[model samples]
Target: MKYRYFLILFTFFTILGACNQPISQTSKASAKKVINAAPEKKIPIDTSKAFKFNDNWVVPKSSLDFNSLGDSQGDTLKLAVCGDFVYSPFGTIKDSSAFSSSLLKNFSIVTRTEKMDNGTFNFQILNHGSSKLIFFFDTDPEASRHSDIFKGEIYDEDVQFVNGIRIGMSFPNFYKTLFDSFPDDLTNNYTVVQIISCVDDIIQTYDFDAGKLKSVKFITDSYWKVDY
Candidate 1:
């Protein structure tokens, strides 16, 4: 009887040990639960208030003496009511002054128009980055290039002002010449201009060196419409 009791006790412990062995199922399930838990981004619901604006930066009387850095009154762009910052998206693969100018030349293809009701208007920003431009249109979709506006936005991939500020500067008339080179119909009621130049505002300045952006200034307190 003593032998049998010892045998039974040993068998019970062996079974208990087998049952207690660490199982792989529980650990894997716990790990998966932890791995799958993550949050998602929330986009805005209301962006119904959007409208487009024109630019009014004028050109110097003499194209030969025009200075991109200063001495540019660029008036036609102002008449269009633009004259601020704009956004441009790009990649690090392509960059240079002539290439950037070629990219700017293509900005005319990016045109968006929506019917408005009185003063109700709004616009939205697309993917952000440096690779695009904004020029004013001379309202004349027909006269090759109207005195109204002549502009578009595109990336230059060629010009860099240090710390990844790749861009090119142009007077309103420079855009006018580009627009005039085309043979499209321009009208007076709704014009086009190439004076729209901004990265995040109607102003021509950008401040990404900081956390948030700071807009550029043209004539005192004049700034582009802020959407954010």
Candidate 2:
């Protein structure tokens, strides 16, 4: 009878020990699933700072329109202009002049001519004293028959695009701010990313070198280089 009682006591202790054991693998997995099933909270995007600037820079607004001058009427025309500069097929032009004496007064202008198969093409480069900024102008009225020729590089911090892009800005932040996506690694050569406007006729190119913006090109797709 004592042996029987002892056996019952031993069985009771064994069951209690089993109850104290760690949870099963299946129970752990179920708990993990329950935790993972909870909805994740998302951060709201700030519309005010999304694509806006306080400066005088203007963002191009697109409107429904077709390229009237192009061969295909269905092709959309995207022309980007920043401040006083207008983009064309050849280059960017400022103040609607290939060589503006009023604007060039502050800077030294160097003019040169290139002999082409059909004719001679004129080119001009404007340089400021001790400034790294340079502007290249196409002076050939016949070569750029559609628009004036002007291309420039901006190294000033005071100058900022409408989307808050500026020289020396980090590539990741610029990419995230402009595109809202993570940027890929850029090589030594400048990585060119073109921004096309849907609502307006505007196409802008941002060139990044060494993880910073090197230059910006505003292009008008409607214009093409005049065959010499």
- Put down candidate 2 lDDT per residue, 81-199, tens digits, no spaces: 23222233222345325435343344456665656576665656555543222233444566533333334444555454434566678766665543442214322222565544433
**Each prediction's whole-model lDDT (CA):** 0.31, 0.46
| Residue 44 of model 2, lDDT score | 58
Q: Candidates' TM-scores?
A: 0.24, 0.38
Predicted structure with the largest TM-score when compared to the true one? 2
Looking at candidate 2, the ten consecutive residues that score lowest on lDDT are 64-73
Worst 10 residues of 1 by lDDT: 145-154
Q: What's the lDDT for residue 224 in model 1? A: 34
Question: Per-residue lDDT for 97-198 in model 1, tens only?
Answer: 222354233322333443344333222222124333323222334633111111123233343321233333332222343222211222221221322332
Question: Candidate 1: global Cα-lDDT?
Answer: 0.31
